[model samples]
Target: MSATRVQVVPNGPVLVSGPVRIEMPDGDVVESDRFMVAICTCRRSDDYPLCDTSHRRCRNVSAAPERLGDRIEREAR
Candidate 1:
């Protein structure tokens, strides 16, 4: 009866636990009581919205924190 626990895993899927409703862009709604679901954020996942662990191959959100800092430093310099 409560809102689902949506956890955004770093460099990974959107970890969803507990009861919740998922609505697709095509106006389709998926309702389920199954907990521990991982929604793909890499976009490169062949499973579309599901995470098949393909994120290991296509790292869409993989970015080194130090690299970003270096870029900032270079730009400031």
Candidate 2:
């Protein structure tokens, strides 16, 4: 069996290698059998633990602006 991987996207959802099963606080279970899954960390997802990409719609870009510039290499280019 291959190991599962989890990647954290800056200001975005966490990427998980599936198939995955998640148990919620209310004893509800969420499962995904896809090759990959996006789990929300920003708590803005309408789907709760599952990301709905709602972070994209957020008006405040509160994360480090310098980090954003670093990622895009604004000066290098």
Candidate 3:
């Protein structure tokens, strides 16, 4: 089994890659198209569900996660 990793950039979207499953708060789990997916850090994005390079407007990497939904943390080895 491949280990999963999720990281929070200083000013970017959640850098999540590797073999992992993304589960929504509504008990919905899905897989990414690629091994890595850059979520929108900037909210001013037209194409959500995928990054539309809107981070440039905010001058950040990507958008942030839900206000109080899915959480990303590193697992201790």
- Pick by lDDT: which candidate is best? 2
lDDT of each: 0.68, 0.79, 0.56
Model 1 scores a TM of 0.59
Order the candidates by lDDT, highest first.
2, 1, 3
Ten residues in sequence with the least summed lDDT for candidate 1: 60-69
Alpha-carbon deviation at 19 in model 1, angstroms: 4.5
lDDT of 3 by residue, 1-77 (tens): 66666665655455667644566568877566688876655656575444566766666433345431234332332
- List the pairs of residues colliding in candidate 3: 12-62, 13-62, 40-62, 40-63, 41-62, 41-63, 42-62, 42-63
Task: Give per-residue CA lDDT, model 1, range 1-77, as digits (tens).
Answer: 66766656667777788755778899987665667787776676786576788878764555443454456567768
Pairs with backbone N, CA or C atoms under 3 Å apart (clashes), candidate 2 = none
Question: Cα deviation in Å at residue 70, candidate 2?
Answer: 17
Write down the TM-score of every candidate.
0.59, 0.72, 0.52
Clashes of each: 0, 0, 8
- Model 2 scores worst on lDDT over the 10 consecutive residues at 61-70
The segments of candidate 1 whose C-alpha lies over 4 angstroms from its true place after superposition are 1-3, 30-33, 60-77
Q: Per-residue lDDT for 19 in model 3?
A: 45
Superposed on all Cα atoms, the candidates' RMSDs to the truth, in angstroms, are: 8.0, 7.0, 5.4
Give the clashing pairs for model 1.
none
* Model 2 segments more than 4 A misplaced: 59-77
**What tens digits encode model 2's per-residue C-alpha lDDT throughout 1-77?**
98998766777777889799989999999999999999886788889898998889985745653365456565558
How far out, in Å, is residue 52 in model 1? 0.8
